[model samples]
Target: MLVDSHCHLDFPDFAEELDAVVDRARQAGVGRMVTICTYLSRFDRILAVAERYDDVLCSLGVHPHQAAEEIGGVTVERLVELSRHPKVIGLGETGLDYFYDKSPRDIQQECFRRHIRASVETGLPLIIHTRDADDDTMRIVREEAAGQPVKGLLHCFSSGRQLAEDALDFGFSLSLSGIVTFKKSEELRDIVRDVPLDRILVETDAPYLAPVPFRGKRNEPAYVAHTAACVAEVKGVDAAELARRTTENFFRLFDRADPSRQAAA
Candidate 1:
């Protein structure tokens, strides 16, 4: 079984035929997925999907790019309060993105801190997003996690070895997406091999970062098998083993999944 730790099924890119997309994922051995909420206002859209799909889980938080768009739902207290929902298993898709800077950098940092605080308040993992802001991201990771302990995973990671090492050292996990399957991902491949299997998770980050052969195509949880294959090839392991290990690590990190949910699905 495989689990796509991050995807954006709520995005309009999949709105027309989302069920067909998910069906393809199950056929591809993707047993589970976690659809992300980029803006707190879209929480209901993501939540409805999680409630609709027995095998899908969702997170509640604001994305860095959407930080400036009236994030009234992601205040520290509000995040903690919403996390109380049974279907909402995690605290974010939050972090920095200096590359785009679509949202104010300072606001992004404040939103990131709120998520970390919420994670500390609620025993849940954080799904972080970072780009061209590695230094600030790692610094915030340490500073925020230091105040109160929390577990998190860097989603769609595309950083250097130092960032990976620092994240691991800080007790964070690293999730690889289809980007590792791209032609220019050699450096990322090396980093993938370096990350401990138990500390790794696989994602599709769909509607973005589509893997090779499917490059430039609309990605979904199903395509994670390709990313898994790419990671296994880099690490000199079988794809099934990679799938099994990553699936195990996925549940280990997102421990809120009930055994009955697994059995029911």
Candidate 2:
């Protein structure tokens, strides 16, 4: 079964047909999904979604876009406390986003560092989002990871080769989103071609960036298969094998969300 390692299921885009959306994902062979929390204030909504679905899990932390708004109230102690929840498997959709500059760069860096520290304390994987700020992102991550190994996924990765190499060297996995299926992502495809399959994961980042066939339309967990298919072609592996390996990679990295534990229960 394929796992959508990153998505925003609590977004309003899925509110009216949340059940149907999830059912479609199951029918499409996506067995699991991790909805992301972009705002600490709205974390309750994200947690509620995860709690309502056995196959759904979540990450807790602020997105870099909301850093300026949430930073005043966010604390490593608080993030750690909330992350104690059984359904929260990872931390942060947090990282630098220079592309939009939605939040002050310094604030974003600080927020990112706090999430990294939380991940270290909780031993949970971090779900990172970096766009147009590869250097600072890698710099901060490397500095914080000094002597303390940090495990995480670079979600919706469409960055340059240097960032990819830096991230892999830091022992973090790269998650491919629908953007990899776009026509202009040749550089990204080339980067994936060189990446070890074991370190690759696929996601839709839905409610956005749908794959080629579904491009320009609202995305959902079900479309992760299309992203997986593109990655398989890029890696020259069978699509099923790609799915299996990425699913394995997901569980291996996010060890707290154990499928075996679910089955046993």
Candidate 3:
């Protein structure tokens, strides 16, 4: 079993073949996937997709890249309010991303703080997305998360050792993505090698970061196996064990999808 914990199935790349994509994921033994929400305007649509599929779950909150659009009138209370839905299992894909700087840096930090507050209040782990901004990312996470006992996973992790250590210290999980499979991702591969199994997760960030053999193509939930294979290689564990561990970690983190409730779905 496996879970693609971070994917954007709602993106247009999967629009025409959503059912096929879901079927492929099922065929690949992907037990579950979380369609990340990048903005509130599209959260409803993504939630509907989750509602439509028995194997898929959804998260609410904007990506840091969209901070400029999110600044006005947004509040942590609002995200908490939305999370009452059982299908909404987490609070993000939110955090800082200076690589693109699509949105203003300060605004991204503010948006990140809001989501952290909501995660703290609602008891849902945040799914952070940091890139080329490790210092700011760790600083904000540490400061805002102070005394909050926040839970989260840094999705698509490609940061340095110090940031990884700090995040782990704060009781956070680290998720690996397609990037780990790249021949040039020796650093990330090393991280995968060392990250404790119980504190690690796997994702595709699908319709985006497909693993090798399909690199540069549109990613889907099905390609998560490649990532699992890569992690297995890095950690010197069997692929089956890696799959089992990540699937277990997935359910543990997104505990809202308990068997009885999901079975009813």
How many residue pairs clash in each candidate at the backbone level? 0, 0, 0
Candidate 1 vs. true structure, TM-score: 0.96
> Which tens-of-lDDT digit does each residue in 5-77 have in candidate 3?
9999889888898999999999999999899999976788989999999889999988887888976746887
Estimated TM-score for each candidate: 0.96, 0.98, 0.96
Error in Å for residue 129 of model 1:
0.5
lDDT order of candidates, best first? 2, 1, 3
lDDT of candidates 1 onward, in order? 0.89, 0.93, 0.88
Weakest 10 consecutive residues of candidate 2 by summed lDDT: 256-265
Off by over 4 Å in 2: 261-265
Taking the tens digit of each residue's C-alpha lDDT, what string does model 1 give over 142-231? 787785678899999989999999899988999999999999989999898889988888999998989988999888889999999999
Q: Top model by lDDT, which number?
A: 2
What lDDT, from 0 to 1, does candidate 2 have?
A: 0.93
* Candidate maximizing TM-score: 2
